[model samples]
Target: MSVRQAQGPAGRGTRPGLWREGLAALRSGDLRLIWLAQVVSQLGDGVFTLGIVVLTVELTASGLALSGTLMAQLLPYALLGAPAGALADRWNRRLTMVASDIARGLVVALLPLLHLTGWLHAWMIPVVAFLLTTGGLFFDPAKNALVPTVTPAGALVRVNALLAGTRQVLFIAAPALGGVLAAAFGTMTLFWIDAASFFLSAAILARMRVSGRVPALTPGPPSPRPSATPLPQGGRGAGGEGSPVRGHLLRDVQEGLRYVWRVPVLRLMVIVGTFINFILSPLPVILPLLFLTVLGLGTAAFGTALSFIFAGFLLGVAFVGVSGSRIHLGYLTTAAMAVAGLAVLALGAGPPLTVIHLIGLAGGAAVGIMEVAETTVLQRESTDAVRGRVFALYESVSQGGRAVSVALAGALSDRVGLRAMVYAVGALTLACAVLLALSPPVRRLARG
Candidate 1:
């Protein structure tokens, strides 16, 4: 199907009514099921993250080992995200997501078993982390690609915002809850809960009816070979014959790349996302280290700071959910990016714990605005057929940027001091925002 046809009433050309139409789709049962599943799964993920980290620490005291475990969880996105995204486009998104949930559940279940049997070595953390993350590589892209299919185009911003808000809520509540659960019931119990959540998510998703409309690729003209079969009935081609399928997978990938490159707004958005992630990724990796080494804080203090960040994110998401669609998103994005940079700078400057928490909150809020706006822009601009591929590239850039940031942050903190590293990253992020503001495409988008 052509882009125009696929977009139908939901296309950009539609006026204010399109938004209402989108909202109607979101209110449907299928979409609600997906949203609910996402919430449950994300809550589980939040708890699992805290529980696993604490579990690893209990087994070993080395900071590097903990970092290594984190790295293992992240590496799958860097390595397999593109291919997994392609697979998501090829297969049933619902099935892909269901399978991912099942796989993750099994992985989490193994953690507790490993602990109970005294077989939980430091190396085991990375191995399990990698396996669980590999499932995420499939799950995320599938969920993203499935959204436009189930929800209305006009309602996308609101739906995205709502989902983002839920995720932020999970971030806020999960760590603290996980910490509490670990203290009261043990880390192994948290893993079991995490495993159960995934199964529950899968069960919910399995019942949703998602009749996704697959985009039909243009076929190539038929050849004159004697054995060449006539074009399938009603298949359109040049000269009224079935057009040969001109694009290979590699070619399709290239087409998606070109599409992003040619669209000035998309290009600018991708660049901003890449840079922001580069600056932000280091925060989580280094924050714990800074708390321990520089601030002389314990795990609980670090958790408190992290919670403050989540609090900021919740506030930001709420603000955006209320006002984002009405605002000129481009300007919001630029301003948020700059504010985030400043927040990070403040974080690194050795403020008191209270001040630090405030900075974290502010930074998280800025990130929330950026994420909601950026994702909405992408959804609005792209066609459904190529959306998966485009998002794949987006995910790849995000993952790669983050990985680089993590590695660089760890190195810089060790060599130049955490304060200098944080300030440098912050300044660089500020530069990126300035560059984004100056770009004509980004400026135009902001105005829109």
Candidate 2:
């Protein structure tokens, strides 16, 4: 059932020729199917998001209507993500993922069918989006948790990097494809296409064999300081023989939070991740104002800038694949945040369009590198018992921060003026970076 390949330390097998390892994982066997399932599902996601926006707008003729659907997409992760993670840890990961995919596909299938039959309502757009994304809240953490178990330990960095890279690539491609399909054949057609993709993803995952349902962590001491300083792994839990988790869901949620609170590094990561999501999140709203009004650029120019930022992200990650293990993990993450702040500061300087694009690229690259570095560290340091919960908490809070930031920025931009708002964001980010740099505990943490 496992991929028939030599498993070695990620350093020896994945470090030297990381891309090769990722390709090897993808070019053959069970890993290939796992990777394909993710790719198929994500492409579907991109298309669905774009098509839905168009469809909702056509039905309601309001940008606010589109925003409602977007909020629906986000609400599940914000509200149910913790519970979803607890379930992932307690259940068979393979089945959790497969079931989620099937359910989401079915929900999405109803959109186009209902529309065709004149049963679709404008209100249903958000309702369906909420249901589909709720499936994602479960599916994402389960799939990520499965990777370290299935792949060589050393290759973890490469595999994680590839998974992230796949999603980002589609962020660019799938939307374009969706726009084309929706424009040519109508948004309902795009929904049908997305529904089909989800079914395909479920089918691929159903056959991919990965170890599932490790014994869950028995509840640690319910105190500010748990009995275990560094949470123990390698007992019956975490791929070993142990009692199944029958713990209260609330207790499981609290365990995940306490674990993060106790780890100095994890706390630092939370601080940094929250700021990163919050500060950078407003760029989409801010960019149009900057380019169209401030810079006197066409909409085409705004799109080009976005392309530049995403390209930089890809390139930064490409560098990470090569230098991942060799770099000091904590230091690289801290330094990347600091550098990103500098780039954002430059962005606020009202430079030429070319220079602005360059700044955006550098900022994005730094942020991208930080993303992989911290994820690898978390994967390495946390035990399998709490990994899903850890990732889910990370996803939830980061997303919640982004949502808050967009609203905050929209409120402030007109009051302070676009340029000043950009300056304020840059200043805050730079200050946060300085704060992290000054923390002795953060500085002393183990280097890469």
Candidate 3:
């Protein structure tokens, strides 16, 4: 049977529909292995983030230094995202992922080793973080591009939802566990654990039996002026000295960009997703202020409110995994945006803590739904040849938009009141939803 035909709606016996279907991807041995690797790596990531903060403070005690270190970890995604994706497309994805994990493991191991040698410095932390995150950038696109290969087309939503929801659960749980672990064993040990996690993840990935094959590109003549204008080059398998099957890396990046722009659904998704990211990025800053300044709540209340948001996200993921195939993605995404806008608008009212939690839950669910829809569509629409690059472009732009949004929102919030800023964001989201609803191409995505 075909892969799609092999997958049926999984929950036939006694398991809860949501749990059964959401975890259905685990039934596939290859996908289960990938998920297991993610669980290990992501948990380690949580601990690693905490360790970074603690280590940086111990080394520098400078808040600015801490911020810089954190930024270093994030900067690579925006800077190298596209090229990383292109590399994933060009190379064997499984090997690319394994290499990335091993590289990250080695880079992380350097931290504890450096400290043991009394050679570690505050500056070195950020440098190592930058390299570690660069490795993740390559790993992410490769893993994303690899998932569809291991999963049935009909099961893609369940797989994506499962992955996203697991990350969310880890996002909530890992830091608390990290804190306890750090207290029992020094922060240096956290690095060791994280390094070990990466290695374990690499081992898990290396065991997968998926094809190592990649798209074969046609070769062309080498550029005459190879000195001044260098082209991205692939290894020549059977052709002449200048003839590699794949184009130059630069040219491949260009093709990925052009492919995204030319594809109407992808174009709409990118533009809309980037804008939504911009709208949401400041929530980390804004939500805290909402609780403290506006609602006169404490840290405990803020944390609880955040929990509601996460819970909502989990619910949203479950909903999509179960029902997503039956719905039109374009419509679902647009409607989710509308709900998100209303939730944002409600937040501006500075309601009681309970009400705020409800709004947060709704808003979070909206975002969750939107994310799964967008990811599923991207995977469905893009061909395997360019899929990694497509995801990389989307991620890079989203990261850029998020960075810009955080900066701009902070500045704008000071000039205008926080509530006013919140109101404006809500209005813009609703407007964007309207734009999406009106786009014929977006509406026709699942239809076609």
Candidate 4:
């Protein structure tokens, strides 16, 4: 594979040049189809979440009931992420994704059918949520592992930016769309729409022409020692022997863990990523309290303020896609974390509404930068053979951190006061940024 030099510092190029580079990934037909499928499926997901929330509220008045639904959605990621990721490497990637979508689509459609038949029950809501996310556990690793194969190596960052941008846009748009549709029809209608979206996504993925195999690694960037060699097509056995079928699933999972621990860059990334997720997890719980109590704002203003975060995320992804390649990923990640810490600190200061909105934007942008940097580097660093398992371990720990942190944040805020909680989060984030900056391995992760 040939290498493309990183452009000079991001803003040195003309505006047109930046825009061209940002949009270049869309020129691949396979990526376009995948992007389209993602847009539809994510929209459906947003609707499904809203519908579940509405249904849960109607079922019970207790807040714990609502929290249980969230826990149900997160459980699969913690329990099955590593195994699912290993399976993605072992199986055909496209087929795994398609099967996941189809399975989820059918399961989702059952909600409305159950309602129509007078069999819908409150207990079923959390069950359905768990099952839906379980399918995603399999789908995500396959999709993430497949992207590098279909896209040109140089455009990988740009492609990741495009996909992340879509999520941000949908984050802002989906609620309003779901609300309007729900008011016009019922919440059950949202489920039907969500079901159809999954089917459509499956149909789109089915049309892609690639073989859906994790191809053997060609000579490119240096890989971490020992994991540098590619596994046979089906993966290796416990004794490093070739097997037409994958080795024991547990062994495959263990290999992924060992690879990350052996690779300095990946090990650091996973550590930092988990810490970052924990620090930021409070936003969802604290933001509402901050707006309603600290800022003396109404629900309408709170919603408006939330949009700034997603908008800032869009801006941040655009920046990375267009000009971020000029900076070493380690330096970029450290800078972004510093900015995020400052934004959180600003929030803790109890400024007026406009200032708070700006903080949200800055914080969101910082998160976007961190996300793209880590994902792109992870893809570049790991071999295709173990990529799925690596992603799975990272994802599993990240989700667990967020889940535990959110619960801890709520408890800590209750004890220390919300402002103090915010201050602590900001301080810890800055400390982590400093640590990243001081690490030699992290700073050395320069562009190829």
Query: What does candidate 2's lDDT look like per residue over 222-338, in tens digits?
Result: 122211234433222333433453667887788778777777766677767877788888878887897789878889988888888898888777767667655666677777788
lDDT of 1: 0.75
Score residue 24 of candidate 2 by CA lDDT.
Answer: 67
- Tens digits of per-residue lDDT, candidate 4, 1-448, equal 4224433343355666556655666877788889999999999988887988998888776588889988888888889889999888787888999999999999999899999999998888889999998999889888887887787546677788888989878766787899999999989999998999999999999999887865443334334433243443334533221122456999889878887887788889999999999888987898789778976788988887778888888989988877665567778889999999999989889888899789889988998988988898788777776788878888999998888988887888888888888888899999999999998767566523
Give the 10-residue window scoring lowest on summed lDDT in candidate 3.
Answer: 222-231
- For all candidates in order, the CA lDDT equals 0.75, 0.76, 0.82, 0.82
Higher-scoring candidate on TM-score, 1 or 3: 3
lDDT of 2: 0.76
- Predicted candidate 4, C-alpha RMSD: 3.3
The worst-scoring run of ten residues by lDDT in candidate 4 lies at: 235-244
Backbone clash pairs for candidate 3 read 232-248, 232-249
Q: How many collisions between residues are there in candidate 1?
A: 10
| Highest TM-score scorer | 4
TM-score versus the correct structure, for each prediction: 0.81, 0.90, 0.90, 0.92
Scored by Cα lDDT, where does model 4 land?
Answer: 0.82
Pick by TM-score: 2 or 4, better one: 4
